[model samples]
Target: MVPQRKLLKVFKKTTYLTTFLLLCIAWSRLRLFFLNVKSQPNAVEYNGGLIDDIKLMKCYRWYKNCETLYAQSAVHDNSFVLWNRVSKNMTDSSLYAIESNWLYETFFYVHLFNTNANKEDEKQPLADIAVSRDPSLVPLTVLQEVMPSLRSSDSMMGNKRLYYQKTSWWYRFWNNPLPTKMNLMNKWKHNNDILWSKIQHDSCLITNIQLYLGSNFVESRPFWKEIIHELHNEDGNSIPISITRKVECGFDANHTFPKNTINNKDLLQLKQKSDLKILQLSDIHIKGNEENSAILGEFQSRIFISRIIDIERPDLVVITGDILDGNKSVDYQTCILNVVQPIIRAQIPFVISFGAKDFSKYATQQEITDFVNQIPYCLNKNSDSNGHLTIPYNFSTIPNDSKDDYSNLITQNDLAIFIFNSKTSKRQFFKDYISLYKSPPKLALAFQYLPIPTYRLSGVFPIIGQYNERNLLPEGFDNDDNLINYMHEMNIKALSCGFDHSNDCCLQSIHDIWLCYSGATGLTAPHSIFMPPSVRLFKVDNIDKSITSWKRNYNKIDEVYDYQYIYNQPKQKHTPSN
Candidate 1:
């Protein structure tokens, strides 16, 4: 019989082919690993193209506060693309994505590398160190941006792959398909494509290519390298430069200024002519776990908030607190950064009020306040233990016919948004009176702190609908009989607070004064898939001195009973103190 070695050598081609294929697989995986590990150096650029889009967004934005309607470019600006950069760079959203993706891909890569490339497992989370990004302001940016597929539907399951078993029946039956589910999805995708036709009207927005394989466990890395290169370049336009619109909310532009207006043009101009869309995301109780492994809650919240910002493009965002779910000391920085960074990047002024769970986990109330003040766009600038946040809209005060900056004196609509630290989340005071009478239950959750009367909720929801039962404000603020009295004096029309994840809104006073209990923006973990999360929105009819609010429970919009709260100048609800 022929020697065993000689028998193996007889099939040299097969052996060489098998070896070649194994190397290819390892190489392909290595490339994928590198892709996710590195911050695409060119991601999230704020280039002139984007600045121009910002101009278009200003012009084509649903709320046309300015008279530049016709001037709204023959082309509509893409707000989605501009906002994408703001989200990716402003927060760790993209970085976390890259790191996570890299770790996943590297797992496979290193395994293959160990077997094929003669490398050993160092037990490293990733193969390489993370790259840094520029956070400073600059013009003409070139970025590698990450975005939810502009092509995706409003479906919560998220983006679908291109080639799937579910092909359109119209194509299968050889007929032109329009108005089909596939067709509608396609058109919705075209929405983003439509934005770029104006910007790059000269070139093809996308190109398609077919791929091939070499072995069952191996693939050609060269083809992948070319694809990745194209992907990196293709992303340049298909990403930060793309646009998508998926809003179910209504937009009202027909304006009838209040019947009696101040004669001052500057002041009248300050009255917002356009409908104000204020997006409220409350009770996103992100746990303060410092570990990178348990950040899905934070990620989900960031992604949802950012996506909603893109879709809603609201004039203001109100984040009713309870943003952190972990102990106040547990990686509060990460929770705070992930929570508020998007608003900061969008340059939208926002307000935050504390909730029962906000300080329940780890950080103290003061620590949370310090974190909030660090964000520039956070208008809650009170350093005391008092209970109020006053945020000014950074509106452009450019006069109708003059070009002068009145930055200091005026804000959008010359209106103010007030946030109250309604004492829903207690300051670790009175303990719960459970089965034990002053037994000091071993696992005590809430109890009133001596002299403060701040009721805390350790592991239970705060009892709502009980007025004045708990401390509604810090002790310092009790000097005022009722906070509404102060709101009346300040001409504050919108006051928002959160503690209850319930969607509760009411016209608590006359003349369009709104007292809103913004429902939880994100649900507590280990919840059922069907437990709908709630968020609040206010569409302000500035001329009417009134606002209409809607409660968004999951994807459904539930209008409150007294949703429309409009002010009539003649009918004063309550008298202000002298």
Candidate 2:
């Protein structure tokens, strides 16, 4: 990590092209200032080359296996299907994702940089430009300063000047220099090296999560080190997918709810017709028009998704936004078509919801709806009535084995499937809904952005300090109580969201509402959106009013491949409903 004031530290203006590779390597890591090699008993040490080598090996091995599969796919279909090339790109992106540097456009497009950028220009800090994809890798103090504090009581829509203060463009423009290892070494040049090492100490959770910033202010988690160590030892035959059970499953044992917490009662009594199977996919970012490679990468997702749909045989498919890369890519329509083309052809009743990404200056919310509606079976609508594309769930139509296609078994009655236009805060439906809907609409199940509060995130994956006070709910609501009250008032059963790529779920037990995350489904142009490709399956039991979720991995090879339960609270019906 080079200092912000020191521009062109490694490569001079004239010699930049000659030292292009060297420059990227320098940009990738802090080679100059890692002096104190602390002898911690169980610490996975990091260096510039070791990190890159281990990450690349994992990536290449994964991609190689996919190539073998691609070659085999030719046996099934001889045609050079445009979308068939998507998987290879997915693997390649994951490879670049681990190392973090190789994925940069600057690596290939050296021309993108202005070698002439001198001291006077005071251009954005390099680290600022390349906002590290994995926050776990950045220094804790930097993360503490930069990222938003998860507000527990703040409204969905509030006048949050402080929230944006640190993360604002002007703030970052002024002070975005992440302190690094060099900063530490320089401080103790004449002082005791042993004292500095003693101060920081040997903590696995602290040390490995960070890159070698010029200073040693940040710490990395033990989990990532374990991932790298496993890969380092492997023969590279089987590229290990970063999978397995969560570090801290369920809620933290230590933290208890306040005494004023609402009492639990079995309120969800369902006259369930039959179990409904829903397939959820999100952040399937496609940028084929940007590059031929992107086309291949996105198509791989299509094939993978199609296979999962065939196996799971979900009755409903819900793509919870970010279908297209948020850019002026001509491939937006093509990408959406590719993702749901099989489902469309199969006539599986599916709905595509909008996210903050879907509506940009380049593509409006209505345009996105219109694009998907082109597919006959896609139940996406754009209207002023009710809410935009709110597909009411029909409880009358049971999952009929009598029919050949069970997906069509669901007839629309009034199950809450609303596509909220986050862009249109002015819309009456959204304004009231955000404030608080007067009454619950049908059997409420929402598909929207802004995840259900991160109260215990720091405890699970240990962050810098005691409390990670961070909340991501959009502004306007009165407080956190407003959100909880809204759910209780509406009998909100479940919410499926997709802005964050990480797979995380938690049950907010006010009315037994489940906050389900359908992690990054596909890879695309921006590497920040890269996570191993996977989708989630939800089985909603109307009879008992119980909703259970299972994750289905695409490239990730895990022992558990079935629909595993994320939350399985089936409220036993003691008394029969009228």
Candidate 3:
């Protein structure tokens, strides 16, 4: 036999070559398929010129052929529909989606011939296309009669056709095409008055436009009554639906308390329900300054708490990190003592995790113990800080424990809260156990808003550093492979942290992991509340102790502040008419 090692080497080389040859053959086939599909008639042509009706009819015929070929060959069926139906004289609702994505390409060719190219050649075909559907040839009165259903359909509620048509706002759709490419291809379409106005006035043909525009952020009201009426007409089973609305229940405008006193004894009566009511007050960057003071002065004082207690009546509250101004000052603990401690005193259970500023210096067991002692409901303890505490902290520490008769609340219960200390640059130890457990009624992984480094924005600290006495990031901090590996090990669905000052948005994930930045609830000017200073409220429901319901309220405080900013007044003009 020829040596066995040499034989093995020959086999490995043959396998590599065979794989490379197969890849080349596949790539060649894909290129040939692409060419064959594009070679269809009018598939390559812009057809910008406007010939007489005789020639224009031919162009439309050719356009139809292209549409047929595109529909059959394109992998994305929607793309074919969008391009063909918006090509003029093709107004069939079923033929097009609410948003015709090809408006730009179609309009580009139409306009290119009209404005920049040879007039007789370009304008003839363009005019021919326009004239084919004109009242002069087809007659406006006749077209209306021909499409009578399209006119009266808007008034009908829940009509499938009407709903689909109204669902999209045509005016918005028309304006959305980018204006960057204003060359010959887009010139003629830009001046098409009849086509554009038809899009706006034929609103009835668009079903969901009313609903889309009638939303709180938009103009007009296609009220619930109308929606209900539509639902009844559409199907026997269609009934009015009501979803529980969550309001970020907090006070920011410094509303004066009533002279009548509300006792804490009476306040404790609200938490007696089995339903879990958790309030998230996140992204509060408290830098001790005038702006921060203004925020606290308006809502952080005793008046604020009194108002909140009277209004929201929450059972438990979670401060999802960021309780300091800057990482520079240790004064954050004092700020919390002043603001958060009083809220805790009112007998409302609240949980807090460290923000970016809190972990400038690592916490010791004593520091964690002292902080928790001051804020009794806080999950961290002296033992927890030392890494000696058991996996789940004692739920007995939760004040007003209703299920006190039952033992093993932490070990056996479905409502376990995990508060990961995200203040440090490196991953926390809690990450290790997250994957091992099942989803709970509430699984919260709290970290500071150390952004996943972007092209423009730098993260909280220098990147690519090893853990050292001065800088404490774990090994391979800057490596993408390491960061993702750490997150996977932690079994995080979605992480909630508070480092950013802009709007809270979500990330790439299956879980509703929201990257929430609640703005400065304290004195920090480096932050802006994107719109307003606010908190979020989640009404978490459990089915067999698994978290089933999570609803959020956005821009609650901002809505109040925005109204004041616009009207220069505190309240709106309307009260209930009755």
TM per prediction: 0.39, 0.42, 0.35
lDDT string, candidate 2, 224-343, tens digits: 221111121123332222211101112122211113111111101112346667788888776534245765677677777778877877777888777766654333444565577667
Better model by lDDT, 2 or 3? 2
User: Per-residue lDDT of 1-578 in model 1, one digit per residue for the tens?
Assistant: 57977878878878999989877745633553343344443443221111112111111122211111111111222111112122211212221121123212100000011112222322111111111121121111111111233333222232334312243553345321111222222212111111111112211111111111110111121111111111111222221111111111121221111221212223213333445677788777766343343455556666667666766677767676667664532445445655765675565666666655566333456666765664545555641245543332323343554234333334222344444455432222112211212322111000011112122223433222322223344353232234444344445555555554443443244433444555556645333354456666676554564556655554444323334543433455797899
Scored against the true structure, residue 481 in model 3 reaches a CA lDDT of 25
**Candidate models: Cα lDDT each:** 0.37, 0.41, 0.33
Clashes of each: 30, 39, 37
Model 1 RMSD in Å is 21.2
User: Of the candidates shown, which would achieve the greatest lDDT relative to the real structure?
Assistant: 2
Candidate 2: which stretches are off by over 4 Å?
1-273, 290-292, 359-365, 382-387, 394-415, 424-443, 452-481, 507-511, 525-531, 543-545, 556-578
Per-candidate alpha-carbon RMSD to the true structure: 21.2, 26.6, 28.6
lDDT (Cα) of model 1 = 0.37
